[model samples]
Target: MNKWQKIIGVVVILALIVANVWAVMDYIHLADTAGAWSAEITQKSFFDCIFSFRQHFWFYTFLSIIDLVIIIVLFICLWRKGGKQ
Candidate 1:
C-alpha cells in the first residue's frame, strides 16, 4: 500500500476501535446500573444487551460486521503481498 492508503487504513482502524470501545463502556455502565457484572447478568444475551439502545441495534451491528470484514480482508491482502517491494 502507498503512504496515503496506509494512513487511511490507520484512521479507519482507529475509528472502529473507538466505536467498539464506546459500545463496551456503555455495556459496562448498563450492567452496573442493573447491579451486576456483564457475565453475571444472564437475563439477556450479550448482543441483546449491547444493542439494547433505542432501536439502532441493527445499524451498529451491520457496521461492526462490515468493519470486521474489512480488517480481515486487509490482513489477507497484506499476507499475500509477502513484503514485496
Candidate 2:
C-alpha cells in the first residue's frame, strides 16, 4: 500500500476501536439504569453483549464490519507485495 493508503487504514482501525469502546461503555450505563440486566450481563460473555447491540446500533455495526473487511484487504495487499516499501 502507498503512504495514503497506510494512513487511511490506520484511521479506520482507530475509528473502529473508539466506536466499540464507546458502545460498550454506553451499554454498561444502560444496564445500570435498567436494574435487571445489570446482573444478567455479568453472566454473558463480552462478545455476547456487543452482538446484542447489533439491532439497536445497526449502522455502527455495519460500518465496523466494512472497516474490518477493508483492513483485511489491506493486509492481503501488503502480503502480495512481499512487504516492500
Candidate 3:
C-alpha cells in the first residue's frame, strides 16, 4: 500500500477508536443521569443545543458503519499486496 494511504488508514482508525470511546462515555453519562442531559444556555448552537440519547446513539452507529467500511477496504488492500518479499 502507498505510504500516504497507510498513514491515512492509521489516522482514521485512531479517530474511529476515539469516537467509539467518546460515544460509550457519553452513553454512560446519559444513563447515569437518567437521560436528563442538558446543554448550557451559553452553549446553545446548532450542534450543541441538541442533546438526546437517540441522537448520540444514531450518530455513533453511523460513524461505526463508516469505520467498518474503511477497515474492510484497508484489509482488502493489504491482502492484495500479498506482503513484502
Candidate 4:
C-alpha cells in the first residue's frame, strides 16, 4: 500500500504553490488594472487605493488563511499517523 501521508504531503505542497501563484497573478492583474494600484490626486500626491487593493486581494488572502489552517491540520494528522508506524 502507498504511504498516504507522503502523498498528502506532496499534495499539500503543490496546492500551496498553486494558490500562491494564483494570488500573485491576480495581484499583478489588479495592480495593472488600477494603474499600478495608485493614481495621482495632485502633482505630488497619490489617491487612496488601499480600499481597492484590499477589496481585490481579500479573497486571495482569505484562501491563504484557509490554506494555512489546512496545512497545519494536515501536518498534525500526518505526524500522528507517522508516529503510529
Candidate 5:
C-alpha cells in the first residue's frame, strides 16, 4: 500500500481498538451494577433525556470487525508487494 493508505489503515485499527476497549469497560460497568439489568425503563424529564445516552455494543463490535479486516488486508498487501521493484 502507499504511504497514505498505510497511515489510514493504522489509524482505523487504533480507533477500533480504542472503541472495543471502551465497549468492554461499559459492559463491565453495566454488569457490575446490582440492578442495571432489572431497571425499569421510564420516561425521563426532558433534560435528563437529552443528557442520558446508552452505549451500543453492537456498533463497537462491528467497528472492531472492520478494523481487523483492514489490518489483514494491509498485511496481505504488504506481503504480496514484497520484493517488487
Candidate 6:
C-alpha cells in the first residue's frame, strides 16, 4: 500500500478497536451501575458518552473493514504499478 493509505488504515483500525472496547466497557458499566446510569443521562457522564458512542459500534466496524479493503486494493495497485515500471 502507499504510505498514506497504510497510515489511514492503521489509524482506522486503531479507532475501531478503541470504539469497540469503549462499547464493551460502557455496556458493562451500565449493567453494573443501574441507578447511576439515569444520573449520567441527565448530566452526560463519561459512561453515558460511551453509551451513545456504542450506537456506532457496527458502523465503525463496517468502516474498519472497508479501510482494510482499501488497504488491500492500494497494495495491489502499487504492486501492479511497480511491475509496469
Predicted candidate 5 versus true structure: per-residue lDDT over 25-65, tens digit per residue = 87666544433444564435432442343335466667677
Q: Arrange candidates by TM-score, highest first: which order? A: 3, 1, 4, 2, 5, 6
lDDT, candidate 3, residue 43? 42
All candidates: TM-score: 0.60, 0.52, 0.63, 0.57, 0.50, 0.43
Q: Model 2 over residues 1-85: C-alpha lDDT tens digits?
A: 4899779868877977887787777666655544435455453564565566556467657767877887789789879888675
Whose TM-score is higher: candidate 2's or candidate 5's?
2
- Candidate 3 lands at a TM-score of 0.63
lDDT per residue, candidate 1, 1-85, as tens digits? 6999989989988988888887778656666665456466665665465556534446468777988899789899988898775
Error of 4 at 44 (Å): 8.9
Better-scoring candidate (lDDT), 2 or 5:
2
Off by over 4 Å in 4: 1-19, 37-47
lDDT value for candidate 3? 0.70
| Window of ten residues with lowest summed lDDT in model 2 | 34-43
Candidate 2 residue spans exceeding 4 A from truth: 37-64, 71-85
Position 26, candidate 1: lDDT: 67
Ten-residue stretch with the least lDDT total in model 5 = 46-55
Best model number under lDDT: 4
* Model 4 worst lDDT run, 10 consecutive residues: 41-50
Q: Would you list the rank order by lDDT, best first?
A: 4, 1, 3, 2, 6, 5
Off by over 4 Å in 3: 35-52, 83-85
Candidate achieving the largest TM-score = 3
* Candidate with better TM-score, 4 vs 6: 4
